[model samples]
Target: MEELTLTTPALLFSAISLIMLAYTNRFLAYAAVIRNLSEKYRERPQDSLIRQIDNLKLRLNLTRWMQIFGISSLLLCVLTMFLIYINQHVVAVWIFGTALILLILSLAFLIREIQISAQALQHHLSDMEESLKK
Candidate 1:
């Protein structure tokens, strides 16, 4: 492979920043939902809300890891740039490659979170359908 340059890893900075921002937003929204659900659960204690809360808990965990990997990737990208600056081209390439892999893992977790969110929405829709059927 051609020698990697500092520019190559620098390119990821904006992308990773945007991704981290998105993940943070997701975390914030989930926090709001969890609080609302917790209050509702205390009031009525419905099974569906409990299950939804459980799903949200899992999603929150996934979001946390996604943020972790994404931040790690960002840090590695910076490290790779420093390596290149120090004339360590070979090590820089390896570190950049690892950063790319970490980014992919972060995206995978994002996809999983989306799937869980979709399932939760579907559950809500099904309940609406059942109510309408009656």
Candidate 2:
């Protein structure tokens, strides 16, 4: 492969930064929902509320893993740049490849979390439609 340039890893910096920001926003929103659910459950426990809380817990875990992989990717990119600076082309290539894979894994988890979240929303919509029918 050609020499690993600083620009190559630098390009990933922008993408990783934006991804981390999105993950953070998702985490914060989940936290808010969890807190709201907790209060509502405390006031009056319901099976549906319990299920929603369980679903949120799974989503929260997925988001956590997504953040972890994303951050790992960013760190690997920085490490790869350093390796390139030190003229370790072989190792730099491996590290850069690993970073790319981690980024893909992070996005995969993000997709899964979104799919689950959509299901939860659909449940709410279905309830509303049922009420309308009533």
Candidate 3:
């Protein structure tokens, strides 16, 4: 059995990066949903509006966390990679590997965000239409 010289931290970093990109896309999708929802709320600001507003807040919170995590992970990955490049040729592979993992993680988060946002949009639109018909 071969040991993973790449290190756990490195894999984590790559995963973080992928997550960040994914989250970014998600946030963008959520923004679109917000726009649509806003229009619906404007048409008739009833009690249901509060629920949608809360839902939007939840999504925004997720977006904020994603951004915070993505930025922090990205900076750390870059710094670690640079340090490895300068000081540890032997461990350079592990550092860069970690960085790669972080990048991927960042993107993964973004993807997750997008899927959730799209679903929310679809669900909300259905509800909004149903309400309008009544």
lDDT of each: 0.96, 0.95, 0.66
Off by over 4 Å in 3: 1-14, 88-134
Error of 3 at 42 (Å): 1.5
Residues 1-134 of candidate 1 have per-residue lDDT tens digits of 68888789999999999999999999999999999999999999988987998999999999999999999999999999999999999899899999999999999999999999999999999999999999
Model 1 misplaced regions, further than 4 Å: none
lDDT of 2 by residue, 1-134 (tens): 47789899889999999999999999999999999999999999999999999999999999999999999999999999999999998999999999999999999999999999999999999989999999
What are the per-residue Cα lDDT tens digits for candidate 3 across 1-134? 34333243455666565766766776787688788878988898877667767777777776776687567666656666566647664465555556556555655655675676687679779998999999
- Better candidate number, 1 or 3, judged by TM-score: 1
Q: How far does residue 89 in candidate 1 sit from its true spot (Å)?
A: 1.0
TM-score of 2: 0.97
Candidate 3 displacement at residue 92 in angstroms? 11
TM-score of each: 0.98, 0.97, 0.56
Model 2: ten consecutive residues of lowest lDDT = 1-10
Worst 10 residues of 3 by lDDT: 1-10
